[model samples]
Target chain A: MDRLSEVSASLVGGFEYNCIIFFCTLVMAVPLGLVITFGSMSRFKPLKWVSKTFVWIIRGTPLMLQLFVVLYAPGLIFDIPIKSRMTAVLIAFVINYAAYFSEIYRGGIESIPKGQYEAGQVLGLTKPQVFFKVVLFQVIKRVIPAMGNEIITLVKDTSLARIIGVTEIIMCAERFTKQGLIWPLFSTGLFFLAFCGILTLLFGYIEKKLDYYKG
Target chain B: MSILEVNNIHKSFGKTKVLQGVDFTMERGEVLVILGSSGSGKTTLLRCLNFLETADKGKIFVDGRLIFDADNKQKPSRAEIRERQLNFGLVFQSFNLFPQYSALENVTLAPKLLAKERADFKRNKAAIYDEIEKNAIALLDDVGLKDKMNNYPCELSGGQQQRVSIARAMAQDPKILFFDEPTSALDPELTGEVLKIIRSLAAEHKTMVIVTHEIEFARNVADKIVFMSEGVIVEQGAPEEVIDHPKQERTRAFLNKLSK
Candidate 1:
């Protein structure tokens, strides 16, 4: 029982890495995704093509492969090694999720009727003003459900950071398998399940807060 | 000078010509109603005048200032376009209120945004916002929505939503207001409320260009009426001459069909 308690505490400590990656990726990716969405929807053909193609490339490949490339590519191709494993994990996760979020953002933004834009225009609003003032919140209300799904997936995807040696929760639990204790590895599931439960509740509360407006 | 002059406007979507050689003028405070059936380019004409769509060829002058001239090869800047668009207000067939904002917010949004451009906005923000809110409340009350000022568009009836949109347009205090089939989206029983607001606006001597199919309402409110067919004006004159006694065969046929 003492061994189990000690192993559980170690796993909890390792879980901090997962939480850090999740929050760091989210903070960077959400706004970056919006920027990419604007790029993909740009009226200028070259910028639109570049953004679309980049999104396609990121979404088509496996994120595990992206993790490998981000960790090793600089060293192999340019002879300048990445100094920190955590930085590589953050870079890979942020880029991967940003590509996913951008498509969801595009869907939400395009769902708005053209009349909304025309109404703003006829009221003498500049295009940027129309977007920020009239359309942005509507888009937020629409994209929330899809974003919730992606964010939950992101919490699980943080385990992938272990591939580049970031020592997330699962990896810390795996150390107990070497000591002939299997239950500690299985016990990590409780942490994930509880975390996801809390996230689900959080998303549900956010959705209700925005319920005053129908998207 | 005429309050508005459109000299030979033309617009096309690829090969489908929508507005071809359309010309008209309106005196200040004149209610000019454009009457036509579907696909008759009435809405497109209103869009062009409101700068929602660019005309292929035309010159639009409001109060003797040239707003749009396809003859000028230089494209106007964004600020210039916005400045020109401020001269007109457009109410859509579908009431496109920002669903997230309340009725008073909808009415005050544009005026508040425009107020931010004032030189003293930063120092006088509270006073300016209070004044704008006061005006918005007055406008909503004018449209008989004083009690429903806090309702969202989804919460309001279709007629009430349309009235809120009318109040929104009037908040801009535009020189010329354009309506594109305002009641077409409302139920027949509900249209009376919206039409009554417009009738009251006309009584206030507000200059308006309305594109509608309601013949009796047009006759009641229009100072001048322009009848359009196949992307061109078939006839235009006083409401009596056009609605009651149209001279052109096409106009006579259209009025005949509508009356039936």
Candidate 2:
């Protein structure tokens, strides 16, 4: 029992890295995703094409390979020193998740009828004001469910950071397996279930809060 | 000068012309009711007047302030057009209230937003909000939705929703209001409530241009009536003269068809 407790205590330190990767990626990616969504939806043809192709490449490639490229490309191709492995994992995860979230944002934006925009126009609202005041929260309400699914997937995806030399919980648990202890590895699943359960509850509460918006 | 003047309006949708060389002028506080069949360009003419749809050829002036002049080589900028749109209010058949806003918020949104944009609003923020809230409540009450101030659009009935739409347009303090098939989407039983609200608005002598299929309501409320067929105005006159004794054969035939 003491050994399990000791293992759990050590895993907590490793799990901190996983939590940091998850939150940093999310905080950076969501706004970045909206920015990319605007770029993809821009009226300027070249900008739209470039933004779409960038998202396509990021979404098409394996996150593992992207991590490798982001981590090593600077050193090999440009001779620039990369001092932080966490920076590498964060950049790869942020770019990958941003592309996925951008598509979700696009779908949410497009689902709004044109008449809604026209209604705002007739009210003398500027385009930006119309988007922020009338459409932004509604878009957030619509994309929340899709975003919730992606966020839950992100909890598990944090394990990918371990492969990039970040000693996250799974990696810490793997050390115990090497010492002929498998229970700690199994306990990692419980940790993940707790994390995902909290996220699911949070999203469900948000959905109920926005229930007034039927569309 | 008339309150609104549209000279030689023309519109086309692909191969089919929708509004062909339409000319019109409305006096202040005159309720002009347009009547026509579904494909007869009545809604198109109304939409064009409100700048919701741009006419291929036309010039619009509201109280001698030029709103749109398609014939001019130097076109007005987009900002100019949007500024003119603020002078008019449009109500859709679908009651297109923001699904997210409460009934009162729907009425207050534009006015509140416009107030906030002024440089001096920050100095008198509370007063501005209070004034808007007061007007919103009054308008909601006027439309018989005093209790529905907190209800979202989806929560309201079709008749109640259309009533809310009328209040929303009235909230803008528009010089002229335009309605396109306001009660067309409502159930036959629900339309009476909407028509009643409009009848009261007409009694107030508010300038209005309405496109509707309600012949009796038109006869009761219209200061003048226009009859259109196939993208052209066949005739326009006092409701009694047009509805009871239309001069054109097309007008007579349409009135006959509607009564039958």
Candidate 3:
């Protein structure tokens, strides 16, 4: 195959990096986000302060800057080489997304009325049971749209891994551009648009399913 | 013998005393109506009985066991408080049904969790859930919400939500039920449905302590009426004796104000 044909054929394989980043970050970040939310909401002052400070620092800076730091800072400061480009990307992306997700989780959890917890207690539910069985579902339902938006943003964010040499789709397209082909770079946008469109539909269906929670 | 006992229950929010030296007891199957104006501690008394509000000073007994005593054990742990919560069901003024759950789920949840806590239920988990579901459906039918079993609390009207909560209360087959002005959050028209349900429960001779301003309903259903004023029970007797032939000035004044 010529360069164009090869580029066309290789698009799926090249984009695999973005897919890995997207799904891996999502699978790890979401539960980490919930754990961070619990830390932020902890009754113990120190845990809450530490959680808030960590989130504040991540959210205050750019993901690109965090990526640079995650890639170079350990090697620079402690003489420890981060050998895997993918590992650094995963760590940076997961940390950044988890900070954002924790805030959304916190807001969703707090928006629930105190009456809900009281009703659970009155029914003799242990506190953990009340949280997991009753409150967790509501939080998930309420935060889905917000989470969906973040996940879509993540598809675009996977492009940032290219800066650290992850050779994601955008990087592949850029290589094609160096070879005097502009079509692949533009076509990458089509790939994202389809991904995002499918995600939007999935989220719309979820929000519809959760229509039972008009309260 | 008394099924529920509260002795000198005292609670204060900051400097404002809510329940001052409140005392009451109820026999099994007796309906006790706690009648009081706002700020008179009727709601606080009910909360204290269920360990919702820790009493600053008091002793509470459920099924002849000392569940709480402020002086004896000043700071009960959450686990201890939770253990005490198992003895009674509470229906809130706002009908605080688990909004995320359907009417049937709201009725079945606690009982299901309670069942899971027992060793026997572990062997027959499916049977436990089925039995609880059947009872919950029957209870929802009893509260006239059989058709609305799959509806969420937000989907139901205030009266219907209140009815669902009443069914939710009966899910655990509580030793006694507590109503914290169950109709206070309802419209005047909607209040009738909740009142009717309470009337039916009273007829069934269910042990209940209802803190309400519904004088007529209270009078008609309560086996014992307690009138409170300024965080004190100023008068208590048979509804006819207390409402119609009250001997205390505070009681007469409160009734007169309500009447007007």
Candidate 4:
């Protein structure tokens, strides 16, 4: 009982770090992904090429390598250091996951029937109004399941922040293991399992709310 | 004077010409039914009239305003062309109702969008809602689907969906309505119901341009019948004159196939 309580106290700091990365990624990834989707769909050849190339590079490379580069490269190359370890982890995550999310978003938006856009134009809706009023809900409905899967994976991925020396839950638990207490490291599973379980329930609720869009 | 005119319109899609120097004109409140085989460019002609598909070369005038003139290459601004578009409404064969909105909401969307840009937008909302509700109910009542206003497109039958589409087009109160094979997707029983509604619209003197394969419906309802073949207007006159005593060998052959 004493050991469990000691490990739990130490893990609280790590849990906070995990929560920050989770929230930050959600905030940054969704909009950035939308921007990337626009870029890939752009009519300008250079802009489209640049956006697609960036997404390809991010998706092609390892996330761990991205984490190291993001953490170290700014200071090494430009002398403008990214001083915060948590910020560096966030930058790596946003870039990596934004690429993935952009593909999903592009797939969802492109899957809609072209006839729908023509119908909107026939009603005299301008481009922006048509997107927001007609296309946005359908895109959200189509993309939700894919996005939910990524969000659940993001919970597990928060532990990768420890590689950048941010004392997230696993890193906190690892500290106690060095003091010859191995059980604390295993007990960290409780925190992860609980977090994942809650996330599953929340996503299930969201899916239910969007049940009107059966397709 | 003609209310709408299409003069020498030409359109093509990447090496395949769809319309070749087509010309037609409609006076106010004229129901013109265009008959054609598949790929005869009937729908393409309608699309060009609305500027949905820009004609490769043509002149289109709506209410004496030069909307499209390929010779000068000077056209009305986009906003001006859109304003002219308000004069006509199109009903597609596919029943392209905005699937997300309820039928009533679909009926109200365009007016609300237009009203939003006006100065007295908010003050007009209630009156617009009343007008939309009344017109929607009347249109639905005409089509015998008044009870399905709140229903989504998926909940309705094909005929009901098409009726709702007609109601949505009528919601704008356009001067002319365009129908592109409106009954092609409906079963026979449903087709009868839609035909009855369209016939009634004709009776009410609502100007309509219909592209259809239903020869009997065309013979019964059309003020004028235009037979098209291979991207050309082959024969045109009153239905009895064109369908019964066609001048062209092609029109007679086409009618013989339809009877068989």
lDDT of each: 0.93, 0.91, 0.90, 0.86
In candidate 2, list every pair of residues with a backbone clash.
Answer: none
lDDT of 1 by residue, B8-125 (tens): 9999999999998999999998999999888999999998898888899989999999999988989899879888988999899998999999999999999999999999999999
- Quality of model 4 by C-alpha lDDT: 0.86
Best by DockQ: 1
What is the TM-score of each candidate's chain B when compared with the real chain B? 0.98, 0.97, 0.96, 0.95
Ranking by TM-score: 1, 2, 4, 3
Residue B85 in model 3: shift from native, Å?
1.3
User: What would the per-residue lDDT of candidate 4 be over residues B50-165, giving only the tens digit for each residue?
Assistant: 66898899898878877678776666676876676777788888888878788877877776787777777688878866776787777777777878888888788888889888
Candidate 4's DockQ: 0.54
The residue pairs in collision within model 3 are none
- Separate clash counts for every candidate: 0, 0, 0, 1
How far in Å is the alpha carbon of A67 misplaced in model 2?
A: 1.1
Global fold similarity of model 2 (TM-score): 0.95
Please write out the lDDT profile of model 3 over residues B147-177, one tens digit for every residue: 9999888889999999999999988888899
Model 2 lDDT tens row, B124-224: 99999899999999999998999999999999999999999899888889999999999999999999989988889899999999999889999999999
Residue-level lDDT of model 3, residues A119-177, one tens digit each, is 89888888899899988888888899889989999999999999888889888888877
State the lDDT at A181 in candidate 4. 89
